[model samples]
Target: MKIEYADRMRTVGEMGAWEPWLEFFVEGIRTQAAEAVAQTNDL
Candidate 1:
């Protein structure tokens, strides 16, 4: 998602696209939480 974030950050100053950027950030958090849960379950 580093590439995705880089692409979004570039256009974030253009205006009206903040919603997608926020969604991307939230999705990243959700993804990390899921991975952490799975790792804990494995132990």
Candidate 2:
């Protein structure tokens, strides 16, 4: 079971398999941008 699970775990260089990673990065950028905008508007 352990080896099978390890085989399923994906690396970033794989095409299409990196979608989740990209989504995470985009979400992080969006969250930071929103926080910055809110801070500026409050001032």
Candidate 3:
């Protein structure tokens, strides 16, 4: 995840590419939401 973040930041900084970073951020949010739902169900 650290490497992936670095790569994403590099693209955003070097090429002014926002889509990849936006996608990555959205996926991370989706993943966290899924985990939260699972944990709530478990509880």
TM-score of each candidate structure, all chains considered together:
0.82, 0.63, 0.91
lDDT of 3 by residue, 1-43 (tens): 9899899999999999999999999999999999999999999
Q: Arrange candidates, best lDDT first.
A: 3, 1, 2
Error of 1 at 35 (Å): 0.4
Candidate 2 per-residue lDDT over residues 1-43, each given as its tens digit: 3453334344455554566666666776899999999999999
* Candidate 1, 1-43: lDDT as tens digits: 7899988877787765888898999999999999999999999
TM-score-better candidate, 1 vs 2: 1
Worst 10 residues of 1 by lDDT: 7-16
The Cα local distance difference test for each model comes to 0.89, 0.65, 0.96
In angstroms, give how far residue 30 of model 1 lies from its true place.
0.3
Error of 2 at 30 (Å): 0.2
Candidate 2 deviant stretches above 4 angstroms: 1-10, 13-16
Error of 1 at 8 (Å): 0.7
